[model samples]
Target: MSTLEPVEITAGSLHLRPWRPGDADAVFAVCQDPEIQRWTTIPSPYHRDDATGFVDGRSPANWATGTAAQFAVVDATSGELLASVGLQDLRDPAGHPGVAPGGDGEVGYWCAATARGRGVVTSAVEVLCRWGFGPLELARIRWIALTGNEASRRVAVKAGFAIDPAPRSLPHPRDGVIANFWTGVLLP
Candidate 1:
């Protein structure tokens, strides 16, 4: 139902592209990182089937439905998967109202363990934010991380997000326990 088409974006040495079927193996491998499992909503065990479903089903479905614009951030020269970023629709897919205005989206990302500490994710985020602001015409892009995710917080700040001072309650990744979360925002 998307009025938009998925497109490729570039930022220096990185290219953000749509997920391909062949990317299942890389997706599975990246999701195996302990940091990813701990900090993200990805399934704890992160089975191969889960990656397959995401690459073959969820990614395409999101694009087709205009629910999210997700990308596999790759090294332009080597074509290596460095990370994943998404601009997720904040509006309820089931037709309920969203927490923000209609044009708001949420930014989420995870870095491959091998690709961490190198600024790959930060650069990719900057590019994604630009795309969201331009072609997607998003009014705002929000970022959230569980409290204590300093690495993610640093990335958001480095990419120009204004961090909120107050922490909010959010569902834990594994259990539904309420956990403190930090939020940030970037506006067009």
Candidate 2:
């Protein structure tokens, strides 16, 4: 597995970067959005500790282990937390043994309530995919949205992904069986 260093990506007015310790409150607040809670896999009844844990442990470990690469999207001018975007399950699917962020990966994201409907997530995801398809050498980046998640679906479409509208999402660790979700694909 190839562990990658974290990076900052600029997509128009959005700044994507590694999660920081001071972002706990913003994380806590954004995770509380109903859309974030319902459509995404973030924990229900989101708590401050969950944000702290994510900022302190989960995010860094994912990058360090090459298991995932998550970015905190913020407004470049205001420095406000705007969304979350990431590539996860980065496996080297070439019959090569250990895990590596190549061959195939999944893109996932959620926008803060205020950032919704502004095309920020779409821009962020596009930039992330470009980076993944380049430096990460990933051949494909996929997007999965729970059924009825039109906002996410629209973002995927805007980001140039083709959706199959099938319940093809694999089981998730936190949400368990994902029997009713749409899947989209972006090939590089």
Candidate 3:
């Protein structure tokens, strides 16, 4: 059995925890915000149904499959859903792909509009990264941001993700052509 850990983390005003059905309403409300739709890949006309489906369907399935891990980032003090963070493409935790099997993982995150400019996401990201590198024993964590997302880039930089010298192409929602991407790696 792949030992899965139950994770709950906190930093400053941010708290990270697993998703629940009740989060559907909160996610729907946040997704409905124009800023989220504009800056992220979420559907432009995000509806309650979409959020409900994500909470009740995709999130749980990911947990069961052990392919991904996602956490809802909330305000520790207010218990407001402020963002989401996760790790993907995990190989292992110790730098070896086969023996002890440590490899690269991807870091992804997004913050609610109201949570922007408040340092909430940044603090939360730091906490999450520490957990990924420490308890998860991940060898490397990669961060990628869309070329024009300066806000996201700032968050990445703040969370120890340095910009690469050259950008690469990454998938984009509105644009058919691959968009410019910034990549950073945290190595153990």
Candidate 4:
């Protein structure tokens, strides 16, 4: 496993950084939103343990292994967690951990209910993409959302993804039997 030197990003009014143990409470609370649970693959009945494990264990492990780079988007001033974003499902063309340039990955995010409608997500997404393209040197990043998830679709579009002319219906590996999602891609 490769170890990455994690970095923080500052967008217009948002700051993104690797998850920290101190963030468990906020993650636990934001993740309880029904919309978050409905749209993202986060467990339906999210528990405190889940949040603790995510912030304290999984997030860092993924980064250390070069498997995924996850961030907690927070208020620039208050340092409050506002959302979760990540370059996930990372892998090279041959399906190995994508720590080097030219690998492909998926961009995913979920916002806190209080943070919605403020353009926070779009701004964060754009900045994250810039960093992904720069330091990570990712060749391409894809965005996928389940059908009827207009909110996510809008964020994807605003972040510069050229969605397929006719959206495709395909199985989303994370959802196990996941199907019928819209797909879009951004190339660097």
- TM-scores of the candidates are 0.91, 0.93, 0.86, 0.94
lDDT of 1 at 3: 38
- If the candidates were sorted by their TM-score against the true structure, best first, what order would they fall in? 4, 2, 1, 3
Worst 10 residues of 3 by lDDT: 92-101
Best by lDDT: 4
Q: By lDDT, is 2 or 3 better?
A: 2
Q: What are the per-model C-alpha RMSD values against the true structure?
A: 2.7, 1.9, 3.1, 1.4
User: lDDT for every model?
Assistant: 0.86, 0.86, 0.75, 0.87
Model 2 steric clash pairs: none
Q: Compute the lDDT for candidate 2.
A: 0.86
Colliding residue pairs in candidate 4? none
Model 4 worst lDDT window (10 residues): 169-178
TM-score, prediction 3: 0.86
List runs of model 1 lying over 4 Å from the truth.
1-3, 90-102
Per-residue CA lDDT of model 3 for 1-188, tens digit only, reads 13345478876667899788999989988787776686776767988888888788877666565445678998788888989887755555543222112556677778888888888778877887788777767667888777777888888888887679788987774656578877888666
- Point out the higher-scoring one by TM-score: 2 or 3: 2
Q: What are the clashing pairs of model 1?
A: none
Between candidates 1 and 4, which one is better according to lDDT? 4
